[model samples]
Target: MIEVIDEFYSAALAQETIRGMIENARGGYRNGGLPVYGYQNVRSTDGNGNQKTRYEINEAEARIVRLIFELYAKGNGLKNILMHLNDHGHRARSGGLWNKATIASIVRNEAYIGWTIFNKKDTKIYGIQFKPRTEWVIIKNTHPPIVAEQLFNRVQALIEERHPTRTAARTTASTYLLSGLMTCDRCGSSYGVTGYGRGKKYAYYNCLTYSKKGKQVCPGHSIRADELDAMVIAKVRERLFSEFNIRQLLNDLNVATRTVKDGRCEQVKDLKRRLADKEARLLRQYEAIESGKIDLSLIGDRLRALKAEQNALREELANFERETMLAPPVITRAIIERYRQEMEQVFIGENVQEQRAFLKNFIEKVVVGESETRIVYYAGGIRIPSGIFPATSEHPRP
Candidate 1:
């Protein structure tokens, strides 16, 4: 404990020292030996003959960078840009042909707009960790910009539009869709599929926390996968096609739109306005410092605090947008019938992964206990007996 505390304090001190240096460095480039592609270093000697490196635009490479941003902003995909550059005999900084990933990196770089960001990543126990935007150190107009600020902002907007936040894991061919959906009733831990018996033909869902951490954490909660899956499918099919449930869902959506959605839209608008205000304030501070109306030292703490607030606002704004975009669909009778038919076909004829995905759409969670299993559907839940099949010698629990 003492050693860990000492190490933590040391790290904190190091981070603070670096932050101070960056705030005071006053638009000087501080590369940790990584070469930036489009810029050449400009060396300067201090009064004491100590040398420092700064950045200046390399026109030839800067032209290529400009072309990349232009192509991307004009609706060219990364692959198209890559092939265009490579086909024209253009090469990367490493003297290799351009690739899709390289084009993506160039497009995402803020250095093209004369902005330098620090503390974007840190070394962690597992690997390099990308730190949140709140923790980043940003220096604006640090050097000559290849792209206009308006163009850069537009590019960033396009990137965000293309990639939205995900609430669930991406589906893969081999992944069992329902693997992480079940939980242990006792300990509220995820249940994993375990295979047992000769040749491991039988699959059961068991509490992973209990298996790995012993009974101190959770008791054993196990159930055969086939029986549970069948029960779940039956329950979903019964509830989904019912006219009463469909009407209730539509009524709930109407209520949400009337009461919740208006308030949420107003909140989102307020956040956006505040974000714009903060950005404008940052720009004013920069202008003040450049015009000698305010000292750089005086504004350091304020700038960091403003940036942190802006980052937080951006996160909240993203959440609100996600909630708005992924709002519950307004289900009409026709839509419900079509959905029911598709679901039935998928459950009967599709693969296990597809069936699991179908289940996830409506079922929020499944909790397994000793004698009963509770399934919480998106609209509601139902409790059923654990063992749906008669116990036999071949299917005995461990």
Candidate 2:
């Protein structure tokens, strides 16, 4: 019986998804996913007050996309293009640092050439499987193309030529604790390490743009790697793990966590009931017309109007359910104490790779200036003056 019900539910879901896909294609709207990097989902109402959603270009992100294409077309390697973007302090649509995979995805996507492609993959009980090119449903001229067709074509060809075998490269794990998390305030690019010495490393975090593109692009912002890391470690110890700060952090986290409200829960239930009632009433009215108890012509417009209302109510119910279902993280005194005891050791004792992971969990980004580096934590951020840490530290060496 359970298996039968599971099969039925899957069938129903597949049908609904197909309906949604067709509607989205006809309406030229984003088909229920994260808005692509250079686009945003715009929700509005149609002439008869029917809800509609469409993908519109985000000019800021679009400009970055164009720059990527331009640079690639001008014969820059993938890594060089990535460096160029990071050097300029440009972030990916997701607001993280630029990477080769992201650059490759943008270069390969046909959407930039004004196409909405779907059904390129199939999801079944096992998992997702890629569909053949023949099965893909592509709608052309869905919106304004960010890149010209010629330019897009050229980039695609270049990508194919550059990686003919399409083999994935094994990336060496980063040893710098804050490699990608740190940003250069002067030129907006991510900071990278350079200048090693005789068995004694002289690593420093310098603007990637200045390191590669030259001082013409950025004034060569830099900080000694050891000094910066020590400062960050000290600040983390001072701000996050301090007794007063831990209590405050816990309080803030507790507040930020979401809770479902009774009002919203009630609203969801009410909307569902109303939708069912409205559908039943409309069905009976149609039946009456079919049975000749009511004139079809007289109630045709009313039936259409009622159906539209049903769709609107369904949308409203979905929105309510989504918002009410989010639950916040719970922090306790015990957890705080455990974290306080372990954080210092984790930051100081862990190898560079492990330290990087730890930093990502708490630090959002580090903006480095000439005199001060603003350490942006995931919770918020704190600024500390540069050149303040000792040349060395009691912290365990990696």
Clashes of each: 0, 2
lDDT (tens digit, per residue) of candidate 2 on 1-398: 99999999999998899777766666676666787778888897766787877878899999998999999988876656776787688877667667666777788788887898877767753654657889888788877799999999888787776663775432222676778888888778888674332343456567766555444456655566777887887787677678898889788767655333657778899999999999999989988988899998898899999999999999999999988887544789888788777877777885887778877887899998877889998777899887573222111111
- TM-score computed on alpha carbons, candidate 1: 0.42
Top lDDT model: 2
Show the colliding residue pairs in model 1.
Answer: none
Candidate 1 Cα RMSD (Å): 27.6
Estimated TM-score per prediction?
0.42, 0.40
lDDT of 1 by residue, 1-398 (tens): 99999999999999888876675345465554564778888887645676767788888898898888888788765645665676677778888666555676777788888888777777674554668889888888777888898887888777676663723322322344357678888888888763344455656667766544344446566566667777777777787767796777667656776667778889999999999999999999999999999999988999999999999999999999888666655547776567667868997654887878777888899888888888888777998887663322332222
lDDT of each: 0.73, 0.75
Worst 10 residues of 1 by lDDT: 389-398
